[model samples]
Target: MAPAGPDHGGSGTPEPDTGTQRRLARRLVALQSAHEFAEEIVLWPAVLRHCPAGDALVTTALEQERQLKRTLEELAHISPGSQEFTQCVNTLAGLNRTHLTYEENQVWPRLQDGLTARDTVRLARQWSGARRRAPTRPHPRLAARPVVLGTVGLAVAVVDRTRDGLTAR
Candidate 1:
């Protein structure tokens, strides 16, 4: 059920026409949306400040994220019980794998190298805070910045979470 990102962990196999599969899909979407929003708001900003050539690295990462969101949008439209849904899930997993590889290999090391232990710890705290307040749904149209995120992002997040609550009920 986990989507690959800071909060990402183990994977799940799709079960046809099962309640578990539906819940898994929903959970994956929510977790990934939150994780990426946090990274864009906090982690990527640190990357821009710390890493040499940070702009290029963040650009590449965002492109990858944009693709992932697009695919997720596709996945949302498919029937979870169908073969197409399984294929979409696999496709998403592949995209997430590539994204994780890039972040783990490139972006993370640079960010770590740039920060002292204390600053790194501070950034982690900020990122965790952002993650907790992040939107539960993907809003691919918005720009990722602390200022914009501090206002419109939080507002949209509240709305999204409210909708998520309604949907869950």
Candidate 2:
């Protein structure tokens, strides 16, 4: 669970090769982007509809996500072997930890109180499906338009997965 909290002192390579660092960075970007998109498509809407302060909560979370996506986009362009890439990774990790903390603390509690148990379960399934099919690449520009995101997600995801290949797995 996102609200489980952050791993402040996580493990890392003291000196990873360019290939290893690049792969790790891409994997992180892919997973995080997919996770955020899932939230955008399913979780955020539920929050907006059910939670009392859903609007405010969603706004904050989305801002955090926007920052993360921009960082991920920058990371995608940097040379994997350079010092800048390592710094970008660190920056991205820090931002992610902060975002997770917000979700875990403020967002999750509201959600738990706002929705029924059955709703949560159903939302979970939807969120999982969204994650499975969401774009693997960061689309920072789309973060501001929740309506379009909900509608065009499938199309954007198809294009992203096509770029990823016939099958992302």
Candidate 1 residue-wise lDDT, 1-169, digit = tens: 6575444553555335556677888788888988888999988888899899999999999999888877777776677788888888999999999999999999988888899999988988998999999988777787877788889999999998899888872
* Candidate 2 Cα lDDT to native: 0.85
Per-residue C-alpha lDDT of model 2 across residues 35-92, encoded as one tens digit per residue: 9899888998999988997999999989998999999999988999788987998999
The collision pairs in model 1 are: none
Misplaced by over 4 Å in model 2 are 1-15, 143-146, 166-169
Model 1 lDDT, residue 2, Cα: 57
Q: RMSD to the native, candidate 2?
A: 9.1
Residue 95 lDDT, candidate 2, scale 0-100: 96
lDDT of 2 at 107: 90
lDDT for each candidate structure: 0.85, 0.85
Error of 1 at 12 (Å): 21
State, as a TM-score between 0 and 1, how close model 2 is to the true structure: 0.85
